[model samples]
Target: MIAPELLSGLPSTEELPCSDDTPVDNEDQNSLPNLLLFMLASLWAERMDWYFGVDMAIYHTTGEDPRIPVVPDAFLSLGVERRKGGRSRRSYATWEENGVVPTLVLEMVSHKPGGEYGAKQEIYRQLGVLYYVIYNPEFWQRDRHQPFEVYRLVDGQYQQVFSTAEADHPYWFPEVGLGLGFRQQRLGGIEQEILVWYDAQGNPYPTPDEVQLQLRQRQQELDAERQRAESERQRAESERQRAESERQRAESERQRAEQLAQYLRSLGFDPDQLPEQ
Candidate 1:
């Protein structure tokens, strides 16, 4: 906890640089984090006590200088306003936010290693971040690390908390009430691997596009059902009209026969006797 007296002297978030302005070596550095941010937004649309930042600066008093921010690929902070002061935050300053540090930090390893395993891990450990995730999809062999790894702060140190087993693909974080995992998906007509959020039961939450597709499929099914019912109703109506027409024809024939019999009786000839001819 930063002392109130010292906190007052620290620079505000507005005055701090949002990030180091380092260009990402690969597209995943920017795209992947934004994907996670978008997923979180959809998952926690109603919640107002969380914030997810991508390539954002996090200023803290734990470091030598509060001005030197640790810009993670992505970070999630709980117990903080979704929007600070009814507006978007310029940067996440621990002192301004009641000294609440990020709960989790994500670092995506690119072509060039960005110290994800050494320096940055130590930084997150010092900041008391509970979870640290390192995703090294393409260059894991070079770094001698797994493609995906999750570390939990245990006794002031980060310990590996995930395995490479298929059954344990999605590592659940009970503290955050969400799980992190990877799956292959097609995005923008390109098939690639992507991170996904999971429930405790290991059910992956559908993307916005998937949800919309499901809705459209359901509507089409309902329309088909309605059409089938209308066709059955029309067939029944046609059958009833045909039966009515047959009944009218029989009645007319009976009336005509009775009229012919009456005329024969009026002519003084027995119709029953003439019917044999």
Candidate 2:
């Protein structure tokens, strides 16, 4: 907490810039976070307890200066208004938020290393962030780390997590009730490798387009089943009609035989004995 004297001296979030203005080195840095945001928006559209930001400044008094911020490529905070006070936030100020820090922070490694493995990790640790994710897709070889890494704050230190290759690689967060992983998915009408959310069972939550496609496919299947059922009903009805027709024909033949027998008996000629035809 900032001392009373220092609290008044701190600059408001509105006074700070939302980003550092350093140009993003690659498109993935921007697009990947957006993909996550898009998926979250679709998945949690009705919920107002979470906020996700991309390239946004997060100001806190834990640092030497409250006005200065550590801008993450993307960050998520639970138990915060989806909009700050029903308005978009210019920046996230911990003091204004009842000291609610970000639940997770992420950095996408660009052409140049951004100290994700060293300095940023420490900074996030000091900031009390629960989870830190470094996505170094292209520069993993140079950094001597995997393309994706998730670190959890354990005992005031960041601990790297490892998982076997047999299962789908996703770091599940029981606190958030979701998982983070990579998948080949299309976004903004372009197919590419992207980050996606998963469930506790390692099943990915489908994107909006995927959900729509599934709904359409399910409707088609239902229509086909209905058609098949109708065809079977028609076949059964036809069989019933044919059986009825045969029954009527037999009845008519029996009645005709009886009538001929009666006429033959009136003539004193036994029809049963005289019949060679």
Best by lDDT: 1
Which stretches of candidate 1 lie above 4 Å from their native place? 165-168, 247-277
Model 1: how far is 174 from its true place, Å? 0.7
lDDT of 2 by residue, 1-277 (tens): 5556766777777888887778888988887898789889988999999999998888987677777788899999999999988999988888877778999998998898888888878888999999998877677888788878889999999998742222247789888889998766776688777788899999998877788888999999999999999999999999999999999999999999999999999999988799686
- Give RMSD (Å) of candidate 2 vs. truth: 4.3
Q: Candidate 1 on 1-277: residue-level lDDT in tens? A: 7887897689998899989998899998898788888888999999999999999999987789989999999999999999999999989999988889999899999888889999999999999999999888888889998888999999999999984524237888888999988878766567888887889999888766677778999999999999999999999999999999999999999999999999999999998888564
The number of clashing residue pairs in each candidate reads 0, 0
Q: Which window of 10 residues has the lowest lDDT sum in candidate 1? A: 162-171
- For all candidates in order, the CA lDDT equals 0.89, 0.85
**TM value for model 1:** 0.87
Model 2 regions lying over 4 Å from their true place: 1-6, 163-167, 188-190, 218-277
